[model samples]
Target: MTTAVAATATAARQGPRPRGLIWTVLRVHRPALLVWCAYVLLMVGWMLWVQHVSGARIRAELDACRRRPEGACIDVMTFSHSMNEGWIGTFIAYSSYGIAAWAGAALVGRELERGTAQLAWTQSVTPTRWLTVKLAVPAVALTAGTTVLVLVYRWFWSADEVLRGDEWYYTDPFLNRGPAILAYALCALAVGALAGLALRRSLPALAVAFGFVLWFHLYLDDHWSELWPMRTITGTVSGHDLDALPASHFWPLHLMTTGVVLTVAVAATGAAYWLLRRRTR
Candidate 1:
């Protein structure tokens, strides 16, 4: 009877408790996440270089404006719209894509593909706790990354008169807000979770995640006329053609994405829990 009790206790301790699950998830995921960090760092580095080039052009524009009298160089007023015309714009746009999609796809989507959910289930932890930890890790990382992105964007966007001339141009929708990027990334993560849980194939999961990210950008672009409410804040510069939309518009997208991400992640986790527990018992 004592041996039987000891065996049961050992089995119970070995099951998927919160602490064990967190540790297991972390152990399996941390190295991959570190590589993700390196990718983000490289992305930032590339952006810095792009900004440097844009800064030079803005300086040149300002210099030209300064060379003439206010009335003669009045075209300089359009500097706001033109600042994003060249290399920096390309870099920023691409960086935004990378941050918004690829960053989280690898972590969230891959887990589902590899059948790691079953491993977690056999342990004592609940599905809700499992999903929470998975979501938390990326969300925390994105928050920190976004804080830095915002600070850098603000500093660079404000540095030159020409750069600041067009609020919307230098504002670079792709580069302006960290929260927006996070929202987008979370959406992609959720898509990945769905793919992971449903398809159970890594390549397909990643493809779906990538497709969703692409669709999101497309939706924002094609539907901007009707959907401008959730993307930007409104402001008008004295001489620019572009209108600064309100950031309030983007809040809904943020909220919607959050809901979708949670739903997919949770549902998949729950399904995993049900499937695993049913199988094991």
Candidate 2:
């Protein structure tokens, strides 16, 4: 009897198994977690390899060309530029679009379509908490992953100007050079969650979310320069003469756009919550 009483006391102190909603969300979406990790690592590793390996090769060829004044150095430089600006840029753009689709279909819509979200709600978790966990986990993960990629990209972008000679106004360089990428990732997540909640169907939500993100990206690409007024330099500049902002003005424009995108994300998240609450009521 004394042993039984002691066991009961211990059980009371230990409490029930700690199966948190956040943990449940994570457990359910572990495959996506792996994918996100792989993508971040791949991009970071590629940039590092380019910066230390391919970039070094290009530099060596340039030095050799300077000494000899003849060789395939121009070809080397051209290849390096294409790899850096063309391939990497395209990968980043597609990855951003993929995030929106994944969030809409795999993260939220599938669960709702399968009635798993309803099952979760019936079990002691509130609808608000359910949706919160859904949004919060992906938001945190996306932000961290995108921020790491941005930092690595920036390092490679500025490391060797001769090898990866990409202009600031280029689509890839412009987007990956600052915190704007993270903002876009978060916006995509929010937009995906909203679409999934509204549609409650995986395929439709995926299509709509991707389309919205694509449109937003295209809009920004066309009008990003107009976000901040360009400063004209009348004097002779070393590069081509064009009406554009100075290099120093890049971050200001990016930050302003980031702010706008993040605001839209917040609004989308708020709307999702309101709609969920109303549906549950």
- Please tell me which predicted candidate would have the highest TM-score against the true structure: 2
Q: Estimate, for each residue in 1-281, the C-alpha lDDT of model 1 and write its tens digit.
A: 99999999998989965556666666777775686577567656755654576556656776877888767665543454344433443444344344334433555445555657556655876555666677567667756765665566556555544454444423244335435444445555555555454555666666765666677556654443343342433354665445444545454544443454455445644564464345446
User: What shift in Å separates residue 128 of candidate 1 from its native position after superposition?
Assistant: 3.4
Q: In model 1, which range of ten residues has the least summed lDDT? A: 224-233
Q: Tell me how far the alpha carbon of residue 215 in candidate 2 is from the true structure, in angstroms, after superposition.
A: 0.4
Q: Compared to the true structure, candidate 1 yields what TM-score? A: 0.59
Separate clash counts for every candidate? 15, 0
Clashes of 2: 0
TM-score of every model? 0.59, 0.88
List per-prediction Cα lDDT, in the order shown.
0.54, 0.83
lDDT for model 1, on a 0 to 1 scale?
A: 0.54
**Can you write out model 2's per-residue Cα lDDT over 1-281, one digit (the tens) per residue?**
99999999999999886369988878988999999999889888887777777777777777778877555345756485656756876687557688889989988899999999999889999999999888888888888888888888888787777666678878788888788888888889988998999999999999999999999988988888888888865556776566867888788888887887788889988999998999998
